[model samples]
Target: MTVTTPSIAVADPVFPGRWVGGASLVLGPLLLLTGVLLRLPFDFFFPAQLNAHQHHPDLMTVSYSFASAGWVLLWPGVVLLAARIGERFRELALWGGALTVLGLFARTFHAGVDHLAFQLVAVRGAESATRTVSETYGAFHVFSTLNAAIMGGWLLLAIGAYRSRILGPVRAVGLALASAMPLGVLKGTTPLSVVAAAGLCLALVPLGVAAVRSGPNPRAAAVAGRLLLLIAAGTAMFLFGQAG
Candidate 1:
């Protein structure tokens, strides 16, 4: 008589599946979309004189400023997603997320302050259009610089994830761009606006691929589904801001 051995059953992986359903997956796309939209009427990332090509001040304020606000909500999702993977660089991801959000908040206030400054200069009648252009443009550069620094932190986390294999080869490239964006800030003379916009656009690629590869994370997906409604709400807010 032969003795038969019992077979062992193995459990399937969990977190990778968790990827799709998470809030980060949902908000990441929305953030990308809103950022892209903000870039459309003009390159909002960069500060330039409001020429005829640009929207009126109010509309520009609504589109450009609020888009930054939307990113504030959107970025945390991505950070959290990174953390969920249990990577060693989770803290870096968290810090990067915090920095990005803080930067956006600062930039939003900067936009408001600059708008007021513009109005004051206009009232003075001594305000040369050239002067207004230079001042306004400079302020945007300051905010863009801050944003670039935050991106540097994010890049560090992305590289960490890639080295650990949490993020795939192609996906790592996108994160690399996200990380490098801050270098533009350091240069001072560099065109940070162009770099930031390009970086943000590149960021979408990794996020999108990760969302696909991780499959549907039920929790993340639910968060994403809810976020879609939030985006609708955001759209309403944008419209109201425009109308108001």
Candidate 2:
């Protein structure tokens, strides 16, 4: 009689990238919604003129801060989505992600300038200072460029997602539609733009949920879920701040 040898099980290769994607999915939209809601009182519009930004310094400052935070979350999500779609489309994803990140970086500058310079002008009623800041920054033109990069990047990402089958056709289409939200900036704030922004926020939820369900790392997903809960709590606090 021969003794049988025991078999050892091998684990699947862990993709640490999934964790980044999952986190991005959870945080990006939530942060964006928070940013938008924070500015609701100011009737803020993307790519708004310097004068408009100056008109609502408090709202602008808060909104930009949250929006900048959202973009920071979104950049990683973009890169992870590209990786998830696999090797064939990886280059496209990289290009798009890079452009989007750059755009978001530019937007951060815009927000900082608006928050600080514009707020100062608003508070002190300094027309000369306002002109100096506006001229120095060329704020609206920068915003226009920022919008183009973000929209173009998202459009490419949506196409890649559809092609990769990572996201289903419906969800991919939703992403494409969401990317159009940037176009609203050209029209300034309107009822339609508000609806579009809401739609974009809703569209992001499915992607995040899918990322959570498909995550290879259970521990990472759990951690992301906990973080999302914290975000929800923070959002509630933000709402309370607004109400107060």
Candidate 3:
């Protein structure tokens, strides 16, 4: 008689919150890249001439629209990242997520006023209208408050991630450093700013890949497909608009 040995069972890896986290990872860089492409061609510190504005209204519009859309991905990414760090860091995650969401919402208002309203006014050659719109929308940014919340929130989230060891040291540090990107933008476009943006994009890649590799779930897969399609459609529209 021969004796048989029992086999050990290996459990499948399931990342509880990877659904939103994964989507955010996949979409976040797409949003960032689109925004950078839109901005890099222009002088962030100076106003465009009316003639220039008229000639490239579609480009401006597409860039602004896509950039604004980026936030839709970004806010969720922030929250899901916090969630991935688990319950031990719950307090930090909660505060960070709330503040980040608030800051992102404020930023959307800024984008609306600047890209949609201001662009319209600029195209029409109304200097007064542009100024009024700028000032009115500017009130919401209150740089100090908005910037602080965004930066602080990310910092806290990064710290939580580091402590939880979910993203490990390198990725956690990268995320923390990315939080400073807003400050770079505030200083106007420079070589350093471009470098910072590129670095942030690189840092986000691993997070996105991890989310994708966390194995497939029906709901997450569907959401990911929709986001991919949305990006593709938006890109196509922008290209078509530019060509026309």
Candidate 4:
């Protein structure tokens, strides 16, 4: 009788990415929706937003913080989605993913500016803060060129998702609702913003949940090891950044 060799199990490279990316896809839109709803009571302008911030600092802080974090998380999730689409459809993934990522970055930048404007309300008062922000509102930045990307990206992504059969036609259209959201620093939410956010959640959350569930359950040790490594790396980078 011949002896048979045991087969070795190999790790899937996409596992870790899928886990984090799927979580991101779920959390990003929900967090952003929370932020928008929190700010909905305020008018969509620097003056009103600053006034809201000045009076309700805690509320505004939490709202904007959620928004900024969500923006940061979207790029990774978008990349993950693009990878799936690219497996069958390249052009849609390339343009849709690239432009969407860029647009997310630009929105993150606006979040930073929003923070600064709110701080200005404390330092210089809401009136002065409003005036300052208004005067400098249209100041040139490289991200200005990508403003259209924010809107166009969603449309392309919607089409791509539908064409790739990654999303149903209804869900793809729901995803496209994100294109309706207004962009800029110190702006507040509108009805359209709420709709857009709802659409985003509708389109991505189910897919995100499925993606996360589709992967094999990672070992507890592996999860712990990754957390430790992340903490160590974060500490190292923070120290390095301080030196820089």
Candidate 5:
């Protein structure tokens, strides 16, 4: 007798896994939006020119502000990858989840540091400004480095999925774009930020739409729930960014 593993192609039709992918697709963008808007205050409102000591426009605060949102964007990719290769590369999912959490941690601390840096710059003198610059840059460097690793993990997962034909080519491209995002900091411009922030963000929309139309599956229902959550969260984040 011989033992054989089940195929993931159309014959097997892993419906449950598809549901997982759908849910992630729906929720990921919403999370990204929420995180993005929270950090917009540092980017859009705070004028760097006001301070002669301003070195880099509080890059940490700005990047992590968007990073908070980046965490949300990662949900779908994480879920999709988990659904596909988790059984074989269980470590991938575990590491990917860890990376997401780590990214969030970095973002949270970075935000806190930004808060302190801002006050230091505002109330204190050039010495404080120097500290603020160093602190902000330090935080950004950490966050960017960690996030790049996370994106690299996702890209690896995406490559696995693409090779398996589980995620299709477009999704693979999106994952590749996502993997390239952390490098945006190297460019350090608004357009670069936009690419990093919202570029791959649209990749999951198709999955969301598919979930809504999927009909009568636990996975589809889950995806629908996530999609609604994302819409609400994204809206809130957007408003928060506008007001800030």
Candidate 6:
């Protein structure tokens, strides 16, 4: 007679296992799209963006918040995409993923600047804020070096995807449009931004759905356990956010 034991899986920190990666893939771009759409009515420039934020603080905050959050959450999904691409084209995936992640970090860095600029509008007036930003424009920063990666990485990643056959050519092209997304502080949406977000939806959302479906079965016990863990994690973050 033999006894067999069932396995309980723990997720790695970086990869975060399949379900989270899949959710990130799906949710990140969608949230970004929502943000882009929300800002479409505004002019697409740093100065205009500053004025818009000052006049419509709440809406702009929500817009930028959603967009920033979406981009901030994208690294996990990129990791998953890179992992899949690496199975076939190791070099492409390696370079592409590294650059893409760096670019994502650049955006996170920009979000901090964007927040500062937004605050300046309330304190110093929109013109003063814009003047401040213009004065500091092109100031030296480590992230400045990675600026090209903003567009460059997506293009390479798209090529890698096509070469790996992980994504069809059309979807690959669409994925590449993410390269067109605007960068820098207090940036506003353009047609390219809309296209980029929509393209990402077309490119990644399907893969995300597929990933979730193929991932570990969410049995009742596993689901309950995960829910409790999620609640605990959220609570911890909230509490810590308020702590000394």
> Which one is best on lDDT?
6
Could you tell me the TM-score of candidate 4? 0.88
Question: How do the residues 88-181 of candidate 5 rate in per-residue lDDT, one tens digit apiece?
Answer: 6666656654565455455455445545555566577546555456555544354656755555665665565555454567665665565554
For model 5, the run of ten residues with the poorest summed lDDT:
3-12
Model 3 CA deviation exceeding 4 Å by range: 1-17, 49-52, 126-130, 133-145, 183-189, 216-244
Error of 4 at 180 (Å): 0.9
lDDT of 6 by residue, 1-244 (tens): 4322111122332555668877888999999999999999999989999999888999999999999988988888888887877777898889898999999999999999999999999999999999999999889989989989988988988998887777878888989999989888788999989999999998888877777776457789989998999999999998999995
Please give, for residues 1-244, the per-residue lDDT of candidate 1 as tens digits. Answer: 5332111111212533333323344554455345435545453323332431133556545544444454454454454444543345556656655565555455455546545544544554323543555555444444555665556555655565565555555555555554443232101112443354455445443454444454434587787988899899989999999998
Question: lDDT tens string, model 3, 165-186?
Answer: 6655665666676566544121
Query: In model 6, which regions exceed 4 Å deviation?
Result: 1-14
Off by over 4 Å in 1: 1-47, 52-66, 114-148, 179-244
Name the weakest run of 10 consecutive residues (lDDT summed) in model 4.
Answer: 3-12
Model 2 earns a TM-score of 0.64
1 or 4, which is superior by TM-score? 4
lDDT of each: 0.47, 0.58, 0.59, 0.83, 0.51, 0.85
lDDT of 2 by residue, 1-244 (tens): 5332111111211442555555676677777666666655543433343355557665656665666687667766666665655455777777766766676676566555555655555666546555565465443554666667766776676677666655555556556664555442212344443554555455455565555555355677887998999899999999999998
Give the better candidate number (2 or 5) by lDDT: 2
Predicted candidate 5: what Cα RMSD to the true structure? 8.7
Q: Which candidate is the best by TM-score?
A: 6
- What ranges in model 2 sit over 4 Å off? 1-16, 41-59, 126-130, 137-147, 177-196, 215-244
lDDT of 4 by residue, 1-244 (tens): 5332111111323643777878888999999999989999999877899999989999999999987887788777788887777777899999998999889988988988998998899999888998898899889998888889988998888888887777877788889998888987877989998999999998888877877776578999998999999999999999999999
TM-score against truth, every candidate:
0.51, 0.64, 0.68, 0.88, 0.52, 0.90
